[model samples]
Target: MGKGPGLYSDIGKKARDLLYKDYQADHKFTVTTYTSNGVAITSTGIKKGELLLADVSTELKNNNITTNVKVDTKSTVSCRTI
Candidate 1:
């Protein structure tokens, strides 16, 4: 209250000036999880924007996973798509 504003008061300004200013109309998504045995699974992909309901039929089909990446093969597994 003493200061000009709280920590989050300028978050909207930051988003508009710093974040969204450089953001393109690109769609992206990612998911990560651990198995019962501790093995990690992750996936990332880009999705098409402004499409009909029929276009998003499949789970990964619409995602259009172009590439996959694996990290920490010996300890954990991580996947990335671009």
Candidate 2:
């Protein structure tokens, strides 16, 4: 038989589909607000390094996501793994 995509391709696709479906099923966002001097303000986890860094385009290029994205923060001028 000829070579098709590969063994990992099938597994990766299944995992992605599973995660997407699960996210749609029960995923939610938590909202919080701040007020000072009668002025209302809103903020949510502004920590820069906390964001997931997986680039979907790049991951799709190889049809796999083998690693997490690395990120940097200005507060401490440090690099953090995401």
lDDT of 1 by residue, 3-81 (tens): 5755776668866778578767767666766555434456555645763111111122124444344543234544445
Alpha-carbon RMSD, each predicted model: 14.9, 17.5
| Model 1, residue pairs in steric clash | none
**What's the count of clashing pairs in each model shown?**
0, 0
Candidate 2 residue lDDT tens string, 1-82:
8978768657778778877855533322334443343322222233234352221111111233232222223232222222
| lDDT against the true structure, each candidate | 0.48, 0.35
Q: Which stretches of candidate 1 lie over 4 Å from their true place?
A: 1-20, 48-82
Candidate 1 lDDT score at position 82: 51
TM-score of each: 0.33, 0.25
RMSD of candidate 1 to the truth, in angstroms, is 14.9
Instruction: Compute the lDDT for candidate 2.
Output: 0.35
